[model samples]
Target: MRSDLSRRRFLGGALALGATATLAACGYQEDTGGSGTSQAWSYTDDRGRKLGGDRPKRIVAQVTAAAALWEFGIRPVGIFGPSKLPNGEKDPLAGPIDLGKVQSLGNVWGEFNYDRYVSLEPDLLISVMYLRDELWYVPAEQAEAVEKAAPTLGVDLAGVSMPDGIEKFRTLAKALGADVNTPRINEAKATFERAGQNFADAAKTVNGKTALLVSATKEGMWAGNAQGFPSSKQMAEAGLTFLEPKAPGDGNYWEQLSWENAGKYRSDIILLDNRHGNLQSEQLKASYPTWRQLPAVRAGNVFAWNPETPFYYEAATEQLDRLGSSLRTV
Candidate 1:
C-alpha cells in the first residue's frame, strides 16, 4: 500500500498568530509611504525588489494560493494540480469556468504541462505549495522563472512567519489589488472573526473531551500538534481537548496503532483527515470492531475532516471558514 505520510514536511508558509484579530489594521502600503495618487504601486518581496504597478487580470493559481486569491475576489483563469472532491470530481471549478477552459501550465510537481501553461497568456501566475528538493525547494525562483514567461508573483506560505489566516488574506489582497480597507473586505474579515469567536466559545463549553486529529493515507496516520494545524487548535478552542502525547516529538507525525492498541488511547473524539479519496472509514470499521464500539464513534462523534477545501489548502485565508466547517457537527 502506498503511504501518504510523506517524509518531507509540507511547506505551509508563515502563520501570523492572532492573525485574524489584526487583519483589519493591515493594508497595502508603499514602502516609502508614497502618495495614494503616485500611480506607482510599490511593494517588496523577500529579496527586496520592488513589485506591483498593474494588477493582475487573468490570474492562475496553483496550490494554496487559490484560497488567498479567492478571498481577494481574483478568480484564476486556471488552476494546477487541484485537489479532488469527495464526489470524485477533478477541478471542481468545472461547471462555471471549468479547468477545461483554462490552459494547463505544467506544475512544479511535474504534473503541470509547461508548454500548455505558456500558451495561456496569463497576466500573472502564482504558486503556493513547495516543490520537491530536486525542483530546488525554492518556490520563489520557480515563480520568477515563470514570471519571465508571464509576470508571476510567487508566495509560499510554508515558512515566512507571517500572521495566520486574517493577516495572510490582508497581505495577499493588497498585493493582488483587493482593498483591505473596503467594506467588502471588512465584511469578510468580520465574518471570519465571528466564526473564530464562536469556536473559542464552544471550546470553553466543551472543555474536557479528549480528541485526536488524525490524517490517514495509504501511508499511515498522522497526529497534529498544539500549535495551529487549525482543526486541532480550533477543536481545543471549542472546548474539545486533545490527548496529545507529552512528547509528540515534532510537528504532525503518524502514530502507528494496530487494532489491539487503537483503544488504548481512549479518545473522546476522533477527527479523520479525509483527503480527496478516503475509503478508510469502512476499512477501519471492519478492522477495529472495538474502535467502532468506542464511545466517540458510537455517539456519532467520529467526524471526517476534509482538508481539501480551498481554505485549508491555501492556509492563506478563510481559516476561520475551515475551522467553522470542520467543527460543525462536533
Candidate 2:
C-alpha cells in the first residue's frame, strides 16, 4: 500500500543557458511566436507573467493542476506525475479527468521525456510552483526544456491563501473558454463554501481540540508544517488548530522525528498521510511501544490526509466534510 506514496527525492539544479538555446534549436518557442490562432486571448499566470496567444488547444500540465482545470471543464492533452498504485488504483489527484484520454509523459520527478513532450507540439505548459523554491512542479533540471517547448504558466501552491489559489485556477479556466456560469460549476463551488462553513462550525464545537498532520515511513515520521501548506492553512482558517513543530527539519514543511519521539506532541486528532495507505502507521504502532501512546492514536481519533490533494471545489468539499465529521465526534 505504501508503494504508491514513495516519491523519488531528487536535488534540483539551477536552469542553464545552454539548455535554453538547445530547446530553441529544436523548434521550441514561446507564445510570442504566433501559431496562427486567435490573438484576442491573454492570461496572467500566478507568477504575474502575461501569456497571450490563441486560446491554448494543446496543453500539457502537472497532474494536480490538470485536476483543478478538469473541474471547470478544461482538460489537458498531456500530464505527468506519480504512476497508478501497484494494484492499478486511480490517483485521487487526477480528479475527474479520464486518464485514458491524455498522454502520460512519465511518472517520477525529473524523468520527463523531452523528445516526446516536444513531439506533442504543446501550445502551453502548466504546473504548480513551490514559491520558496522558485521552482515549478516540473523538475528544475527539465524546466528549461519544458518551458522552451511552449509558454509555461505556474500556479503557486504556497505564498497565497488556498481560496486564492483556487480562484487563480478558475480565472485561468475561464480565460481558456470554460463557462464559469454553468449550473454544474456553480453548484460545486457552492457545495465547497458550505462544506467549509460546516467544518468551521464543527471545529468550534470541539472546544479547541488540536490536530496533527503526519507522514510515516519505515525510516521515520514527519510532522507537517501548517505554515508551509495552503490546505493546512485553510483548515486553520476553518477553526482547526494544527500543531506546529518547535523546530522544523525540512525547510518549513516538515519536522523529522524518530518513532521514539513521535509521541512528544499531544494532539486531540491525528491526520495521517493516506496517499499511499494506512499500513505504515499500523506497522509503526506495532514496532514502537511509544507510537501507540500518542493521545490521538490511543483514542483512535485518526483521519486520512493527502497533502497534495487537489484544490478543486468537489475535492475540497469531500475533504472538508471528512474533517468536519471527525471534529464532530471529538
Using lDDT, give the best candidate's number: 2
Structure candidate 2, residue pairs in collision: none
How much lDDT does each candidate structure score?
0.50, 0.73
Candidate No. with top TM-score: 2
In every candidate, how many clashes are there? 23, 0
lDDT of 1 by residue, 160-246 (tens): 322354365467667666666767767656665566677666555445766776555443345555333533444454465777744
Off by over 4 Å in 1: 1-39, 46-50, 83-101, 104-109, 129-152, 159-163, 180-185, 217-219, 226-228, 234-240, 245-264, 280-283, 293-295, 312-330
Global lDDT of model 2: 0.73
Per-residue alpha-carbon lDDT of candidate 2 for residues 1-330, written as tens digits (9 for 90 to 100): 111224532123333333544534533335454556645567766655566757788888888788889888888988887646667777787777788998888776556777878888898888877643334447667776666667777777764556767888898899988887799988888888898889889989876788998888766677877766667688887778988888764445677787778876789888887776434567767886777889998888888877776878888788889878987887
lDDT of 1 at 296: 68
List ranges where model 2 is wrong by over 4 Å: 1-38, 132-135, 277-281
Candidate 1 global lDDT: 0.50
